[model samples]
Target chain A: MSLLEVKNLCVSFSAKGKEFAVLDNVELSVEQGSIMGIAGVSGAGKTTLLRTLNLLQRPASGKIAFDGVDIMSVSQEELRVLRRRIGVIFQSYNLFRNKTVARNIAFPVIIEGVNKKKALEKAREIAEELELIHRLGSYPSQLSGGEQQRVSIARALITNPRMILLDEPTSALDPFLTSRILRLVKRVNSVHGVTVIIVTHDMSVIKRVCDQIAYLEKGKMVFCGPTHDYFSEYYLSVSHDDHAAEQLEKAKKILAENGGNKLVRLVFWGEAAGEPILWKCSKGLDVSVNILYGEIEEFKHGPFGTLLVATCGKDSAEFLRRLSGNVYKMEVLT
Target chain B: MISELTRATLESLYMIFASGLLSILLGMPLGIILYTCAGSKRLASVYRVMDVSVNIFRSVPFIILILLLIPVTRRVTGTIIGPNAAIFNLTVAAVPFFGRLTENALNTLPRGVSDSAQAMGVTYRQFVFMVLVPETLPDHILNASVLLINLVTYTAIAGAVGAGGLGQLAINYGYYRFQWNVVLYSVIILVLISQGIQLLGTSLSRMLRK
Candidate 1:
């Protein structure tokens, strides 16, 4: 069953007497016990979508159902109850500067009127799990960025929330810290059964921890599907580097100059990603293949990649036809 | 001479303590209200009125403020001469000053602190007492210390107007009778009190900082 569902959501902001839409008719659904990543460029409304999920930013119009309840029409008391079930971690960590780490982690439960001693004990247990037990007494200022991020994760997990929304959780960390935090997120999902909806610009983050991916552009969800499919179908559009496009252009130029019959782009995923389809096709069909560019990325499901190549031979058409049958996708760039 | 000096010192202390307590009790809430009001769209007009009032009060000189408040002081204390009446004036003067200090202190708090509190679904009461108050307490203490020192000087000025304290002793003996010794002693005592308050405030804020 879907843990959360959004339909026809619209959010807008008025600035200087002009109303501008920040999110326009966006739709999404997150399955129970699954990890989904939301990716977009700056000002693409990625953060706004995340905030709207928790009702931090109310939409102008839409329906959001959480755990089979339409949250948009819920009473204030019911809304509060829904909020308790969904934890949110911000980009800046936002630990209370005056509170000790222990107090910061235990703050949610403490406000719920839980016994202070019991809350702190539960906080300690979470801190230990997140490897922050030693810094329990220290203030947030004393910890490094990675440790602060861990503390934030610990606080989010301590509430035993059925779902957690992380807004650019690893945007401020280095690569090593990013991977460590991602590993912790995966563990939280697997061990605690918490549904995760993380908004990030980093593809590696999506590849590492997310089972599904959603791409937002200009406040609209452009693509949403399984992780490998995003890598296969829409990876180039989201990748900031224009290397693949450049390579495709270069391959076209070479094909034009060298009189090659066709320049082709191929995508591989799952079992096809492991097979040497290009080499087998060339040797089997007596065609000469020139690999212009290739990149393979590891996703949660498996390896997915894109390749651009130039082909020239008597049986090049047969080689192309044979290669198309084995690959996930084939595009002719002649 | 020693007994007179002691009496004047005690009187000054009484004025400072009473006015300081009253100003903080009134002022801290004013500060919190101002801070809260500024963030609210519905309270924009209320914030404007309170902001203008605070600025107007803070702009007037303290000595002139005492003179202007004589009628109000008389109504409150039934007399315009003595430490009690002086305290009434001092509190009136200090509340706005402390309230502005509080607003500035709360302003220095990061926006995320409140955002996180709201995300946790805290009640409005818990957000104020648990998050807002404690987050800014150290700044409050430091501002209060500064307020206390200002109150001490105000107390002395009030004494010059028949509120019996060190200021009256210095003026009557040292200024009129040319007994420079009394002025010297009073200056030393006032300096000591200011220094003591500053020291206490610094350490208390430091202890509460983390």
Candidate 2:
């Protein structure tokens, strides 16, 4: 079973005595030991979904099952216990102002019944891993924002949770710092075999670390699939840009001149864009491969995008069949 | 005369500390509870009740509040005309006042602090004791100082109602007997004590901040 399964979750908030739904009928499945990205614009309920995984935000109606156990049905006592197994790092990096860095990192462990000495020792180890050992004695107020965020991440890891939910972990960070934290998160997931669900607005962050991506829009999961598919799918779903439209117009004119039933448009959704598959095939065969419009973009998983091309002549059908191996879809636009 | 003035000052100090300690012990939690329940639908009724209750207690003038508590004071302390009785009366008036003050200070904490505490998996009770209280320590100290200084004023008024302290000395010798020098000394001592508490609170708050 997946580590986390959210089925038809819904959350509502009453503002000025008017009830409004923030999340509506959202379903998601997170596999064990996999890094998943939750990406969306503001007000899309990305943070709400992450909170539901830890049962921090209760959905009005839905089933959130962690490790095949129904979290929504658990008693308050059980829920507290369940919460310890799922760690959460908030966007605000809320460090207890009265605590030193070491104590802040040890807080979760101490609360879990570990003695203070052992908790602090464990905190030292995690801080070392996060390169924050030197700041152990400093209070959060004394540290820079990046250092405070490091303490927060170290605190989340000290408990050895099964899954960790990060809400915009690097939203306020610079690009360089953002990548560094993303790499750290990737390392934590891979090294600990822990499932991770990150809520972020940065596509580059998702591409850099996430294997699967869920995109939310207006409190709905508009798309959820492999990271590679998200790249191609997102591009496909956007209204056709002027360049692509203009390329299609030219392709239609060329197709009319070619005067054949075999004229076709080809689109590739993977790294095949960097290859010369079309040039190789049409060169040997009696085929003409006219590149109508082609674009390639590097994505998290690998290179992902679509290329548009037109082909015609006797070997066009066979060429199209051979080319289908590299492309996600091949459409005959005559 | 010096010994008598010294004893009156000590009596005022005793009343302020006792009532201040009791008020903080009782009211800080009450305030935190009110803060935790702020805007929560489940605790809306409790919050409103406590809000109104605090407002009512705060509305009563200190002298009248002390008189109103005489019967209860007699039951608790078996007397109502000494510094000890003034402590009880002062605490009774101070609890709701300081409770509201504590609530307001806690409300000024960063919004994310509480959410992060809960997300960290601490229980509601733990959140208050460990996260909420510690995070707002500076604000709490300042609130306590304000409450204590107010208690100083209240204790002086309590002294006028047969509760022996600076107020009683100031009234018996200064007002009733027309000894203007005694009134001047009492005012000076009260002002000095209030300034001392405020200074300590300010330095402690600044030190605790970073």
Candidate 3:
């Protein structure tokens, strides 16, 4: 079921007497109890969209229905109540430097008028769960970046929010810390049934934890679907191969130098991912195939692979047609 | 001479304590107002009025301010030539001074602090008292110490106009009567007090640092 529905969402910022849309007529829907990753390059309005989701930044015009209520039209008092149900964690952790770890975790409950002693107790329990009990008395500055991030997560979770929005939560952490945070996020989602909407530029993060993915480019959501589908369609761009673009460039060079050779990019997911579809197609169509580059990675749902191949034969066109029908996606590079 | 010096010192301390306390109490809210209003679209006009008012009052020379406030001082305290009347003037001047200082202290906090607080559903009042004020307490203390030291100097200026403190003693006996030794003693005491407040503020601020 759709837990949050955003339609025709428009957000703009005016600077130096000029106005520009940060998010223009964007549309999205997040299913209940699912992890949705919003991915985009910097200045692509990913963060703006996340901020708009929690009503931290009001849009210029749009309809945002959260948990079946029109949040944009709610009164200030009602808005506050609605915000409490949705937790937000920032890129920098945003822990209270002045407060101890325990106090920082307990702050939301205290704001809700819970007794101070009870709030502290609740904070201690959450700190324990997040493996931060030993650092409870320390301030945010004293803790490591990962510890601070956990304290922030503990704070968000202590409120028992139905949904949590994390903005680049692991961008600053090392790989080991990043995995730990992702594990905690997954545990929170499954164990507590909390819906998660995370905005990140890292595709690996999306592959590790997100069930669905949304791709934004220049303030417009260009793709939104299951995680596997996004990878299949935009494999070259989103591949963990930092050299995907460079490799593609090199492939194009080779294709141009080797006359009469065809360069094709193929994406395979699900059942086709495990089969030798490329080899079969080459043999059946009587084409010579040279594998240029390939990557097979496991996503949350299953395995997805992208392969770039160079083919040379009289029946290259027939080979391409057969491969296109077998693979999830096929595109001509050169 | 010893007894008179003691009396002047006590009177100076009294005026400083009363005016400094009043300034902090009043100025803190003013500073919060300035910080909060500056960020609020609905309160843009309120921010402008306050910003201009603080600038206007801050620009007027302190000595000139005392003179200009004489009639108003008399209206409040029913006397315009003693420590009590000077306190009314001192507090009026120092309130805006400290208010601006508080605003600067609050501004030094990372923007994320307040943004996180708001995301957690805190009201504006709660944000100021619970998050903004506490987060900036160390800076606030340092700012307050600076204000208190300024207050000490202003008190001496007030004493020049018969406000009855160390300044009056120094001006009457040393400046007018040419008693250099008297001036030396008062100067030494003023320096001691200023250093003392600075030491206290620095220590307190350090202790509060997380």
Candidate 4:
């Protein structure tokens, strides 16, 4: 069953005397013990959609059900109690500058009337998990951007929220820190069985943690499914790097040989991208070679991508002998 | 000479202290109300009415205001001319001035701070006490110092209505009696006092700054 459900959500804003509808009937769901990804580019209303999940930005019209309770129908006093169950992290970190890291993390709990000692203890517990225990007494101004974001995550998670909404929690973070925070998020979900909905442009964030991924385009959800399926379908479209295209074509032919029509085009990079695939393929003659379309380019991780080519050409034996195990392949589209 | 100088300084200080404290009490909240009520987009018409009232009061010169308020001052305090009467008029004058100063101070704060507080479920009263007050503290202190300095000068002008202070001392014992020594000394003291306040205020504000 879905722990949090947003159905028929719409959001609009008024600017310069004209109202513009930003979110158009977006719907999403997150099950308990799952990390759900809402993947979108900037200005795709990803933040607006995330804000609607907790009614931070009240939708123009929608139904948000949390564990079967329609949050929209609750009174203001009751909604505060409901909000306590839903923690939210922002892209900006949003740490209160006047407070120390521990106090900042403990604010939501303190607001809920948790005693100072208890709130600090809870904050400390989450801080240790996020690896922010050492800086609990430091103020937000004293920490780096990444450290502040970790404190924000610790703050949100300290509430023991049934479900948490993370809005680009790592966008402001450096790559190393981003990976660390995402790992912590996964740990929170798996170890604690808490539902997590992360809105982010980082595909690795989805791949590393998310159980399901939903793609949002211009306020509309275009795709929603398991992370592996999301990677199979949409991940390729995002990695239009020339090298990724070459590797993708090769994998297609190999997967198709095994009757794997629904294939996941995994792009390799660094040592993985340059692996000796053709050398291994020399022994397998049944896998013919056909390079229909191939592109290669340098990336931060080196050349990687789709090799959208058929593996069954007349010179297939020669092709297989020439480029043998050095290549990967998947089936051509029917 | 030192004893007389000390007594004169103490009297001047007393006049300034009494007027400044009274003005703050009367003006700060009025300024807050004027700014908050009028500054609101939802209450634009009410804001306009308040704006007109403040403008009318502010446009009148302090000396003229003191003269005009003599009857009201007499009715309120049973005295037409004295340090007490001057305190009443000076406070009345400072209200509109500080009201404008406070309005500008509040305007300098980031709109995000206010919106964030509201979104966090803070009530209007708590917004004022917690968010708005903290964000505007630096500006508020600066304006209050400026208002105190202005009140010091206003109290001097109150001497024209038979009020007693350094201004009266200068006119009564120095200018009228041709004791230029007393007038020169009083003028020097006033300048030194105002300069001290400005310096103290600036340093204190700098110390308070993050």
Provide the TM-score of chain B versus the true chain B for each model in turn: 0.98, 0.97, 0.98, 0.93
Worst window of 10 by summed lDDT in candidate 4 chain A:
A261-270
Q: Number of backbone collisions per candidate, in order?
A: 0, 1, 0, 49
What is the per-residue lDDT of model 1 for residues B1-210, given as tens digits with 9 covering 90 to 100?
Answer: 999999999999999989999999999999999999998899999999999999999999988998899899999999999999999999999999999999999998888878878788888788889999899899999999999999989999888899988999999999999999999999999999999999999999999997
* Model 1 chain A lDDT-worst window of ten: A232-241
- Expressed as tens digits, the lDDT of each residue in B1-210 for candidate 4 is 567667656766777778787777777777678768865678888888888999999999988888788789989989967677777888888888888887787776565344334334454565566556666676777877898788778777876557777887878888799989988998898898888888888887765544
- The regions of model 1 sitting more than 4 angstroms off are A235-241, A257-259, A279-290, A312-319
Candidate 4 lDDT for residue A230: 52
Model 4 C-alpha lDDT per residue in residues A103-128, reported as the tens digit of each score: 77887777666799998998888888
Q: Which sections of candidate 3 miss by over 4 Å?
A: A236-265, A276-292, A308-327, A330-334
DockQ of candidate 4 relative to the true structure? 0.20
Most accurate candidate by DockQ: 3
Candidate ordering by lDDT (highest first): 3, 1, 2, 4
Better of 1 and 4 by lDDT: 1
lDDT of 4: 0.72
Model 1 whole-model lDDT (C-alpha atoms): 0.90
- Judged by DockQ cut-offs, is candidate 1 incorrect, acceptable, medium or high? medium
C-alpha lDDT score of every prediction, in listed order: 0.90, 0.84, 0.91, 0.72
State which docking tier applies to candidate 2: medium
